[model samples]
Structure formats: C-alpha cells, structure tokens
Target: MQEFELINRYFKGRGISRRDVNLGIGDDCALVTVPQNSQLAVTTDTMVCGVHFFEDMSPRALGHRAIAVNLSDLAAMGAEPAWVSVALTLPHADVQWLEEFTAGMHEIAEYFNVQIIGGDTTQGPLTVTVCAKGTVPEGKAITRSGAKTGDWIYVTGPLGDAGLAVEARKQHLDIDPEWLKKLTHKLEYPTPRVAAGQVLRGYASAAIDISDGLLADLEHILEMSQVGATIQADKIPTTEAFRQSIEGEAKWPYILAYGDDYELLYTVPENHKAMLDNKLNQYGIDAVCIGQIRGGEGKIDVFDGEHKLDISAMGFEHFAEDEAC
Candidate 1:
C-alpha cells in the first residue's frame, strides 16, 4: 500500500476529537493550543520489535503499549492526556496487522480522551514510537526534583506481574496457565494512571512511573531530589495474584529488578499524607506506602523484618546482560 494510503486506511482520525487540536493527522504539522493556566506535558517512547517485545507478539498489544508507555510518562508528571502522535516502522504493510494495531491504539486513546494529532510511517524492521502530550495546571506538575527528605514514598497499584510474564516467557518457566494468563495481561495491557497523576497534583511531592522496575525508576527521583530512601521489603505490594502464582523467593527478582510494571512511584510530604489518603481512594487507586525519603545522598536501603536485605541494582538495562533484582 502507498504510505499515505496506509495511514489513511488504518490510523487517520482514530483518536478522539479534541478542541485543543487545531489540526490533526494528514497535516504537515499538528497545530495544538495549550489551555490557559496549563503547561503542556510531553513525552516520547519508542518500542523496537525484538528489544522491547518478542517479535511474534501481537500487533494489537504493541499498539496499546506504544501509546501507554508514553502516557505513563505524562502520568508521572501529573498531566492529563490530550494528544498523541505516532511514528510506526513496519517490515511491510500487513493489512490485518495494521487493523488490529490501530484498534488497540484507538481503545486506549478513546478511553483517555486523547487525540492522535500527527506522525509518520516508514519501512523498517519494526518499531513504534509515540509522542504523548498532556496538560497540567501551571506550577502543579509533579517532578522528580520536588521530593523532600521528610516525604513518604508510595506506589500506585501492584508491581512485578508484568516482569513475571517476561521471565516466564524468556526462561521457559512453567507458570500455571491461569496465572500466566493473568501475568501476561499485566504485561500487555498495562493501564497508565493518567487520572491518578492528575489527582496527585498538589498532593505529591515527586512522582515517577515504574517503567524500569522500582529501584531503577525510584533512583531517578532520588538523584533529582538529592535524597536517600529506605524501603520496607514486605511493604512492596506484589499483589495477591503474584503470591498465588509464583512460589518462594522466585518472585523477588521480577518484583525488584524486572521492568515494565508501568505503575506510578511517588512521594508525598508528611503533612500531605492525610490529603493523599483521603483523595486517592476516590480515584479507585490504592497507594501503598513502601518507603520514606531521607537526607543521605541517593542511598537506598531495603529491610526485610529486622534484617537489612542485600540487593544489587539489577533493573532492565539496554545493551547489557540481564541481572536479577
């Protein structure tokens, strides 16, 4: 199919219509207007075929993930999603695959009320890049540098399920069929916490999405805030499904080191803790308290009961051998 024809066939006008989008797909450039008293929150994420996901994975899920990951970035910064642009590279124009992919993208885009403004398509091995834009009231966007020494650390939703799916697939571990189904659901259809991010606004001191495992992603906040932290190992909510699915210490590596959880890890000052507790439940999000920020210089300590656990920094790294959490 022709390049423009392919886009028109599968992607054009797929996202929800938005007033902020002065111009959308098929244009030389997308023209958008940021609302008064709001700042644009923009983020881009690229997913390669083999590196980011198995080459044989479904295009439908790929479409969702391509958009979801970037949305996760906006969520971390307390932004409400508004517009998205997609740059998709393909080996060839497989009509069926493209249809399913766009369907997946449309599902999330409509759910979030975001518009697909513009993008490009090209021939390549296979890669999907999405640039997501959102809005946050001026001076209200949560950032990594805003964390303070007295802030309490929290995470939205469970962790390690997506990571478990990766390990089960890569190592050929015999995970229970029912459990594998659950784990893979997390891996493939992660729900970006866009609403939670918006609600966090003035409540959170700092926030980050857990795309690269808890420790690795939390490090971004630590580095930026110039503070240390102490995590209670038992307090890391690994979900009841995870406990019922995996056995013994086997789940620890996935919970701590494996990436792709896409949950939000954030900090709230002690004074605002009550406000967060009161408001977060209204969003139907459970924020688990796992740690506290401290005055040290980026040191992270994890404790299991009375003993301090020894853990290495083993989160996902591009172009490096995989390591355990």
Candidate 2:
C-alpha cells in the first residue's frame, strides 16, 4: 500500500477526536492548543524490531506499547495526555497487520482521550516512534529533582513480572502455560498510571514511571535531587507468578534491575504522607511505601530486614556492557 493511503485508511480520522487539536493528520504541520495556566509535557520513544521487541510480537500489542510508554513518561510528570504523532517504518504494508496495529493504538488513545495529530510512514525495517504531548498545571508538574531527604518512597504496583516475561522468552524456561500468559501480558499491554499521577501532583515531591527497573529509575531521582535512599528489599512488591517462579540470587536482577514494568515510582514528604495515602486510597490506587529518602548524594542502600545486601547491578542501559533486558 502507498504511504498516504496507508495513513489515511488506518490512522487519520481515527481514535479520540480532541477539540484542542486545531488541525490533525493529513496536514503538513498539525496544530494543537495548549490549555491556559498549563505547561506542555512532551516525550518521544523509539522501538526497533529486534532490539526492542521480538519480530514475531503481536502488531496490536506493539501499537499499544508504543503509545503506552510515551504516556507513561507524561504521567511521570503528572501531565494529562493530550495528543500523539506516530512515525512508522515497515518492510511492507500488510493489510491485516495495519488493522490490528491501528486498532490497538486507537483503543488506548481513546481511553486517554489522546488524538493522533500527524506523523510520517515510510518503507524500511520495522520501527515505531511516537511523540506524545500532554499538559500539567503551571509549576505543578512532578520531576525527579524535587525529591527531598525524609520523603517516603512509593510504587503504584508490583514489579519484575515484565522482566520475568522477557527472561522466559530469551531462556525458553519451562513455565506453566497460565503463568506464562500472565507474564507475557505484563510485558505487552502495560497500564500507565495516568490518573494516579494527576492525583500525585499536589502530594508527591518527586515522581517517575518505572520504564527502567526500580533501582535504575530511582537512581535518576536520587542523582537529580541530590538525596540518598534506603529501600527495604522485602517491601518491594512483586506478582504471585514472579514470586513463585524465581528465587534467591536468580530473582534479584528481575526485581531490582530489569526493566519494562511501567508502574510509577514516586516520593512523598513526611507531612503529606497521610494525605497522600488518603488520596490514593480514595482513588483506588494500590501504592506501597518501600523506603525513605536520606541525606546523601545519589546513593541507594538496600536491606532485607537488618541485613545489608550487596547489589551492584543497575537497570537497563542501551549501551551498557552488561544489559539485563
């Protein structure tokens, strides 16, 4: 299929139709309106065929993930997602694949009320890049540099299930069919904590979405805020399938360093702890406090009860010598 025809049929005029988008797809430059008293939050992510996902991955899931990850970044900044532009590269236009892919993209975009503005489609090796935009009240966007000593650390939900899914796929480990299904779903269709992020704007001192592993992403906050932390290893949340499948030294990387779980990792000050709890509970958000910030310069100490465990692995880095995920 031709590029313009492909976009016109599958992407343009689909998904959520937002009033803020003055001009959407088919235009040379899409126009959008940023709300008054708000700042525009923008983020972009690129996923390649082999490097980011298996070539055989579902087109629908890839479409969902492409949008979800970008939204996750906006969510980290406590921004409400508004619009996205998707640039797609493909070997050829497969009709069924495009249908499933656009369906996935539109489904999530509709859920978040995001409109697809404009982007380019070209013939090449498979790759998908999405640039997402959102809005946050002026001076109300959460950031890594806002963390403070004495702030409580929290995560919106469990971690390591996605890591486990990746490991299982790579190692071909013998996993139960049902458990594998659940783990694989975590890796594919991740839920961005959009509402919880908005709720955290007034309460959280610092916030980040766990796209990279908890330790790796938390380090960003510590380095930016110039504060240290002590994380209770046992308090780190995990799924039942993850706990049942891996144990001991084998489990540490997935739990602490492996990436792809898109939950939120945030911090709240002592005085606002009760208020944060009440607010999260009221919104039915399941957040867990795992540690506390301390006075230091970008250090994180992990403890399993009284024992200080030696952990050296950081999260996934694209160019790191030893990449875990």
Root mean square deviation (Cα) for candidate 2: 2.6
CA shift of 201, model 2, Å: 0.3
Candidate 2 lDDT by residue in tens digits, 53-114? 87778999999999999999999999999999999988888888899988999999999999
CA lDDT, every prediction?
A: 0.85, 0.88
Error of 2 at 181 (Å): 0.5
Candidate 1 — which residues are off by over 4 angstroms?
1-4, 316-325
How does candidate 2 score on lDDT?
Answer: 0.88
TM-score, predicted candidate 2 vs. hidden true structure: 0.95
Each model's TM-score?
0.95, 0.95
Give the C-alpha lDDT of model 1: 0.85
The 10-residue segment of model 1 with minimum total lDDT is: 316-325
Q: Which ranges of candidate 2 are over 4 A from the true structure?
A: 1-4, 314-325
